[model samples]
Target: MSVRWSFSWEDEEWLATRTPPADNNLKLAIETLIVPFGRSWQAVDNYLEVWRNMELEHGAEYSVSTPSAAVERISRDTVEIGDLYDQFEDVRLPVDEFVTLLTDLSAAMRNQ
Candidate 1:
């Protein structure tokens, strides 16, 4: 199955809220990670509602893979868990290459 890997910090907060203790964790995730991306909390709320339904119906697995190894490989400036979409843009990897990378990422996550 294909996955959508967003580096938007807004998206991260949305993911955090899907779990229990929605407010605290959502705040933490936003302040610590999402805020730097210049996202609005209100927009995050709207997107979360939409994404939640999609994930539930389609079984899409949204994930954050900030493994130490991956971080080291990508380097700190661009490899941070909250900056993947930026990295994806910077790297400008072709669609085929990106699919290969995602495939590899999935395999690694599964192995772990």
Candidate 2:
């Protein structure tokens, strides 16, 4: 199957307030990631809603991986990091480091 990868805010608030990426590859990457959760944007949104609620209530973690069963831990770590950020605004790496990490992650996902 062919996949398109792209990135955009899937939430209504962000969607209303922000402009989507103009870069085609970035857009494709975001779309590719959303496909496994569900093939439509709305499905991804619904999953995110449930996921966020689970994180809030029970600190649940979720992962997205190719092969559908590889059980990668990075996504789980990302969730935990986000939780940490919510609890402690000062508990974060530098912006450049965070960007590099995410860039590497996106590369890995693309390779998969």
lDDT of 1 by residue, 75-109 (tens): 21222223333332122122333333334333333
lDDT of each: 0.32, 0.33
Candidate 1 deviant stretches above 4 angstroms: 1-33, 36-39, 63-82, 85-112
TM-score of 1: 0.25
Clashing pairs in 1: none
Q: How close is candidate 2 to the true structure, as a TM-score?
A: 0.29
Report the lDDT tens digits of candidate 2 across residue range 1-112: 3222223345421111112222443323333333354324444444445545655665434433322222122333442122211222222223233233344334433443
Clashes of each: 0, 10
C-alpha lDDT of residue 42 in model 1: 47
Give candidate 2's whole-model lDDT: 0.33
